[model samples]
Target: MNNLSKTTLIDQLTVEVYQNRNILGQEAAKAVVLKMKELLSNKNRIRMIFAAAPSQNEFLETLTKAEGIDWSRVTAFHMDEYIGLPASASQRFGRFLKERLFDTVKPGVVHFIDSENSIEEECKRYADLLSEQPIDMVCLGIGENGHIAFNDPPVADFQDPSIIKSVELDLVCRQQQVNDGCFTDLKSVPTQALTLTIPTLVAANYLFCIVPGTNKSEALKHTLSGPITTDCPASILRQHGHCTLYADDDSFELVANG
Candidate 1:
């Protein structure tokens, strides 16, 4: 087996694949906070999109503890949410942000997709809102299947125009949620989700993606070494001007042992 390690890509895009998952998560969170501070020093306001998943637990915890960030001037948004789920549901991204980042920092604004509302109407409304702003940064994670947000391989579109859309969940993605303990079984997970499109996520000035654990190894390889295609939605990050990836030992196997 190959040992995992970190690699520095061109520009400021560094990929750190650590042996310790907790260390990897903390480092990623710290890097994001530092980047946010640097951007805020120049920009009047900052907008951010966050991904909610068990993989992000450690990173989010570290971020919520980061000081020196003016949360009041920052507007927050989430990557995606399960359609038809109530905001109060434990599985809801809205509730996750409220408990994890929002209540702690109280950002200037929080734009959460109303998954409980009609999916089509909510998608159009959210797309309009995102279209009006240039997001400063986005924190995301890759699914075990290499999906970004809810843009599963089958539904992902690199040329998508709208910022938000409803997508059917892929089998691998659903299984991932179960494996991560987000749901008791496959049937408990939603069949569809409201996800931010590829163009919208890439529109951000910076993208900080965190991928940890052994389960993510294959997906990480595809994201880092594969062609930029919807087959691996995260591969699109390669085209962004300022995109960085953080991975732990298991997830970094390909890059590290190369």
Candidate 2:
């Protein structure tokens, strides 16, 4: 927990601003590791969902090297994946997690969405795996558009009845992939993706949302100060009692004086 600069609450969500992205990732990993240890102390195993993007690089790196936790007792899942990316594409969420986390920690169980299969069947398959257990934790990030997972504003539903569903990606959401260096251009990014619903994400017992960078400043501001609406999807984090947002000074700049 180094370089913590500010802390506040918006509704039930706790916001922690660190001096930089490195500190933000370090502190977030430290807190999540402690939570994992606590949950494992009582349960035979714990389930966790992860978000894959450059925003998670430092956090995943730190978490993989954290000590004192039995990774064998942890089960992992990713929040979303593109429906059309080739299996070898590095931009694919599943590949991103494997290279960053699953391969490093070797979790007891890692459920991945196989988009190569029929889209409908793949969604149903992944949904069944998610429903088999209660998710104990989720490590996620907000999009530049303030969306969570792939739940872009145009398709986000706070009261969604589905555990997972495929949605057409909006222009801003697709362009963000290019902005993040995941795709060479917006045309190369997948137009559709399967994402865990907003309800499914908040259903987790604890949520750690790691968002950083000046690129995220405007979205972060809307998420923290705007009304709880799908217009700024991540704003719903405020309603989750156990969710915490980890942001760095750069990302918090716009909201610092609010």
Candidate 3:
């Protein structure tokens, strides 16, 4: 594996913040979509993983609106979902993807975790579905606590063999859901979730991590400067072969000033 501790690795993966968050989101989306298009042009098929949250709103909008890409050749998968939430639920990650991207384009396949089903069954089912294909690209966002997907500080593991598992929600992660308008209050959000594991995320050929806003500044710093431990789940991206971080002025402040 490549050494993430090397100065060149940090310099290579770190992207300077943009003047505005929206602009940063759009640029990152454009770059990833273009790369996806290039890969699809050569391979004829592409599998992609998407992360859903208020933070990814601009990025998804820009990707869905972009022209010339053959959406029909793309297969889509998402990062995580709240266990026990129906697909029709407003807070379901599947619904977010359908409303935000799938409905707008003719994608070949969309495999969504059925959070309403038995947690273990849902995890096994999604893992089986994903096991068949190698992900061409993954678009994700870092949580305020530096969590990736639902791999909160307590449960994240970079070397775990399990591709997907049920996990309890952290207090900070739940609060963030409410703050993002996914729910009116903490009680409205599910306490448990099914998320793709860190190992699965790192297996992707390319990773595009988009983080914006002042709220993410501290987490961004931890992700970039902190040790690669489960306590800082997003930091595992540093070990991936091809990973890019896109942040806005506020989110990149720590890295920039350092």
Candidate 4:
């Protein structure tokens, strides 16, 4: 928790503000590592879900470099992946996670969402994989539209029965893909995606939310002060028993000013 300058406990959520994004990621990764160690010491294996995006770059990179943890006892799953995107597409979410962290670690298993397969069967298969074990933790970020994964405002369900479901991408979410340089333009972005539902994500025993960059200021503000509604999907984090939000100055200042 080095250089964590401020903290606010809103409801069940603990929000930590860092001096910068690098520090934010480092501290979040450190906290997650500590939690993982504790879980592994008591449990035979731990399950983890991760979000793939430029916002998670620093946290995932720092986590991959952390030492002394037996990654072989960990099983990895990603939060979402686009439908119909070719495997070769650099923008594919699964490909992004593989290049950034999954390939770097020796997790006992890495379950990827098969978006190319039948959406119904893919959803069932992924849900079965998730239901195999309780998720110990998740490292995620908020989208510019305040989305948690692809559960955009229009599609997010707080009590979704299915663990994994498909959704049509929101305009703001698609625009963010372009802004993050995952695609050259909005037209290149996939309209539909398979996302772990809001209930599935919040079900984790612990949640490490790393949201950075000035582009996230507005979303951060909404999540921090706005009503806890699907209008700001990430706002639901406030109700989690063990969730912490790590944000940098660029994004935190928006809430600070208000």
Candidate 5:
């Protein structure tokens, strides 16, 4: 349990298991940097969407320290945002990314979901931006309830007609925010959010899903071994040819044991 313990394929998804969260984060960051370097070599710029959570801390920290990626050639976006959180709130997804990633790398362009605006207008605005060009990559995570972004089980749609939409956060999803310490309590978490749809996320050329911690073990197991259904939104990754799910001993245990 001191290094990468396993690498296997499930459907079109690649699953990598490491000894612990630190190793998992380092390995995932290395792979992401390598892919970024390769893509930047061929293209002038790349657009990427990222997830904001305590779970992403190690990976984002390591990624910011990596070399060879031209930050000036990158445009950054976030996968979701609370519909009512003040823009200045530390719990805001955009603010989290700003402090942890964007502020450090300073990507050429950073697009934040304008939660302060009308939900309808904000969704349309973000969707239009996402539609302007193909998303090169997406760095995300799985929720305790098997959600991707804010696409909780209750509302996930693999074939969502819209690029981005407003959604009511399910109980499990909101509790996860408290569990992650992003909020002091479930009631403090916003009940609704704006999220890029499943289709939009899976449309990215490359998907790097970093999920760690024992709290996520059950969800990770369901994602890798359970049926591909909206009930487990993360399970949809199995159908994406270029998606990779990274997990540590704690999170991968249930899947490994099965």
Candidate 6:
């Protein structure tokens, strides 16, 4: 991990490309864990939000294995979920995070967005839960269409008035779900989802964006090179003083070359 190369995009964001997703996740887990521990030294509790996706598997696995931290004082939250998925469905973002980290480590509190309930009430409920305190950090990834969480370009708002809301998924975002093998086909994917708006995600004191695979090369290009606008939702990360984007070799080749 120490041998991983580092580069700055526009001299505002720090980009580190690891050899592969495995090591990339491991190193990212290390950094986030260290930051969590540092925050805990000054505070009694810390709240964290996680993005559920195959891209986050390595990081979550390594994070659950990290020692010397008290899980009881940490609260967990997930970024988004499909609106129509069955409770027992493995594709549910809540179930995904539970199996990955929540169930393994047993955090003090785990708040999940209940899509089965009223979308309006669910949004208010989750938003209220998040507003109880400032978020310490967010562990997330960039979608193929350059989205953060489910904040796809169609609904991403930099000055969103609400914290969480229901949004229609863009074609590229829906396709990425199938591309990631979360669903059998496009028809099986949910068109609507509950997502934390851009303002909510960026409100965290720190953000760790873990993106891997060559499949993300085009989006990563736009994220690093494009203007800071909702057109490339993840591009807003450039304005955060404490955010870091981690990519693997294949995912960052284009950015590294240019």
List, residue by residue over 102-183, the lDDT tens digit for candidate 5: 9999999999999899888888889999999999999999999999999999999999999999999999999988988878
Q: Rate the local accuracy (lDDT) of all candidates.
A: 0.85, 0.94, 0.85, 0.93, 0.93, 0.92
List candidate 5 stretches off by more than 4 Å. Answer: none
TM-scores, in order shown? 0.93, 0.98, 0.93, 0.98, 0.98, 0.98
Write one digit per residue (lDDT tens) for candidate 2, span 1-258: 458899999999999999999989989999999999999999999999999999999999999999999999998999999998889988889999999989989999999988888988988998999999889999999999999999999999999999999999999999989999888987899999999999999999999999989999999999999999999999999999999999999999999967
List the RMSD of every prediction in angstroms.
Answer: 2.8, 0.8, 4.2, 0.8, 1.1, 1.0
The per-residue C-alpha lDDT of model 6 at residue 6 equals 68
TM-score of 6: 0.98
Candidate 4 lDDT tens digits, 1-258: 469879999889999999999998888888999999999999889999999999888899899999988999999999999998988888888889999998888789899988999999999999999998889999999999999989999999899988999999999999999999888999999999999999999999999999988999999999999999999999999999999999999998889999
Residue 38 miss distance in model 1 (angstroms): 1.5
Q: Model 3, 1-258: lDDT tens per residue?
A: 111111235733655467667887788878887898789779989999999898998999998888998888998999998887766788889889899988998689999888778777888899998999898899999998899989999888888789999999999999999888889988988999999999998899999998988889889888888787788899888877688887877787776667
Tens-digit per-residue lDDT, 1-258, candidate 6: 485966565546778889889989999999999999999999999999999999999999999999988889999999999999888998999999999899889999999989999998899899999999999999999999999999999899999998999999999999999999999999999999999999999889999999999999989999998799899999999888889899999899888777
Q: What is the lDDT of residue 226 in candidate 6?
A: 79
Q: Which ten residues in a row have the lowest lDDT in candidate 3?
A: 1-10
The clash count for each model shown is: 1, 0, 0, 0, 0, 0
Candidate 1 has which clashing residue pairs, if any? 18-249
Could you give candidate 1's per-residue lDDT for residues 1-258 as a string of tens digits?
133355667333557666677887788888899998998999888889999998888899898899999988898999999986666689998788788878988898898889888877898888877777788899999998889889999998889977898889999999998999889999999998999988888889899998998899899888888777788888888777788888887788765565
Query: Global CA lDDT of candidate 4, please?
Result: 0.93
In model 4, the worst 10-residue window by lDDT is 1-10
lDDT agreement of model 2 with the native:
0.94
